[model samples]
Target: MEAWLDGLPADSVGLRNRGLAYGDGLFETIAVHNGRAVLLERHLQRLAVGCQRLALGHDATLILTEVTRYAAAMGEGVLKLMLVRGDSQRGYAADPGRPAMRILQASPPAAYPVVHAEHGIKMFPCATRLAEQPMLAGLKHLNRLEQVLARAEWQDSTFAEGLMLDTAGRLVEGVFSNLFLVRDGRLLTPDLSRSGVAGVMRSELLAQAERAGIPVWIGDLRLDDLAQADEVFVCNSVYGVWPVQAFAALNWPAGPVTRKLQAIARSLLDA
Candidate 1:
């Protein structure tokens, strides 16, 4: 039995589409606002970069046209665009001339557990470690078994997210959102050079913090650093900023810094 592809169109693309065959692709989940995507350009730029890495071509204007059309049809919702290496015969060797296939889906944004947000999140020290793939780091690629496993680490709804570290035991990010720690009045986030997806809201928050006169340090972080952290928050484009209230007994407040960044994040959402 073919499982349903949720939120995707019923009109099927070929089953042999190389992307389905090989997972040779990338995707971006963008929030459409007021009939326009909040950060459509950035998402497409990331998609183009992903295509460039695989030697597949992407026409920015063409994709933009489709995105505009899709958003127009979907109205205000999350639009996910998947770009994949085009159909090809079964082989490990990629054909240099292969084009790309685009698949689009739209859905209402997953309503965040705002009640948990109000009380703040309960986190798990996830056992799953994200593999450090330098070539694939910072790209939202389709190969996400690591995330899938980490997400399965805790089924308890009390925990809003899970903290995933690298193989070296360095705190990298959460299961889905980018992490931030406040220490000694400075903001610190993990460097995505070795691993983790460079999130859109993560980049925006970093820049916004700088503009707000907050200094940021991006480097490897140990569990101890996070444990001793005065404030901690996780962010994604749709959720804005959610403070980590407790991580397996380490209690934290939605402090002044978290609230300040929350205000900044809300402004971007309202924009």
Candidate 2:
């Protein structure tokens, strides 16, 4: 098993460590399968992009290398890398010269009960709306209080996830995963341009769609739209893809298209 860090130091005061003062940081939850990181390059790319956007020092390569070392020793599990502006003093104004400080960790695999894959999951609409922030949209930033509160709507194990809507009442994504729906033989997904995390699995599925000649529509969706969907599924890097068996009164089957995508996702994990 890989070792861990309890927290950062006390003397960690720099006018640049905005993460401690204002949660000015980004993070990624990566799946380490069979001693390999699924979509390693893509995750690194996204981390780098996030650092650039936050105006943090461009040194994601160093962090990626550190994560790779821990993943190599941690065996099969999950890896999380939190990159934040280094110890910045008591304000939001970021110091351009402060280097980014990163916290890297590896944890025991989240036991994704296999039953969810076979029987599917029950999800509920949450009262908390996903805030619209174009600058932070699609980036896995630390300001995830919305997800934290939305997920608190229930503690039922049977309901594996929560479906959250954006401020505009448009279907955004699950509390922790990207969502896709099939209707009239067409596949549709909420565009992350306005909100939601652009999950690694979502990107993989889109690539697979192109390779399979499947056309996907990225658009705004509402509750009635999902109710009319022929099938529904949620995906993340680790969970792969899970077809929604039921959400509220709506029911969906493990549609043929979803099955195919799941197969591909499994293959990636297996590889």
Candidate 3:
């Protein structure tokens, strides 16, 4: 399907568009069900934060309106909302006064093996590491070369997802999802203050877990923690949650905590 540029059907963006020129933009991948965008508020909240951090001014109300309308039209699928810094001249300095550009695209819902969700999956240990850029940390910006490279590290069907670490070798996240570990009835996830995308599903899980009286920890995580974890799972807005049964020689079961959170995530995505 063709994408909508500023709410109009378009085949291409301007050559000078900053998003095309230098990846100067942010994007959100949303799951739409029953004509509604799932976890829309959280997605918009993250987009707003990205705009603030990048100094890319945008009308939140306009985006919300457009996204709602687009999701309704889409019915059921994945909706991608991209906000760029508009067009710019032949220079690095962006036009501060220029209005941001909005691009929306819809695609069929993702298809993954049902067994992966039910029986769990194996994770590939990616050699590519995320760089610590505090300025861009936790923002789903257009520049995603690190994740791209990390994902390319695996081609085998056996590994459903790849685990990424920081340049300092601290576990950060999955290539396109958030990583979580359950130990002693407590939930632990890697800190994204220095690297990684603070995924929408990750945030939602943290909030829901806390509400359910689960102890949550957001701090540094390492391979040692993974070895000690009783349960491991990876989550994203698109796929909900997939329990990680194996990562290298280490193995974990789809323990109670993982199943509880998986059910919560399933309900959110299927809602």
Which one wins on TM-score? Answer: 3
Worst 10 residues of 3 by lDDT: 1-10
Candidate 2 on 166-223: residue-level lDDT in tens? 8899999999889999888778999888888998889889889778877789989999
For residues 93-135, what per-residue lDDT tens digits would candidate 1 score against the true structure? 7777766667778788668867655667878889999888888
Per-residue alpha-carbon lDDT of candidate 3 for residues 10-116, written as tens digits (9 for 90 to 100)? 87888898998899999999999999999999999999999999999899999999999999999999999999999878999998878789999999988899988
Check candidate 2 and list the clashing pairs. 14-87, 14-88, 14-89, 15-88, 15-89, 16-88, 17-86, 17-87, 17-88
Supply the global lDDT for candidate 1. 0.81
Give, for candidate 1, the lowest lDDT window spanning 10 residues: 1-10
Q: Best by lDDT, which number?
A: 3
Q: What is the lDDT of residue 241 in candidate 3?
A: 90
Candidate 1 clash pair list: none
RMSD of each: 3.2, 2.8, 0.7
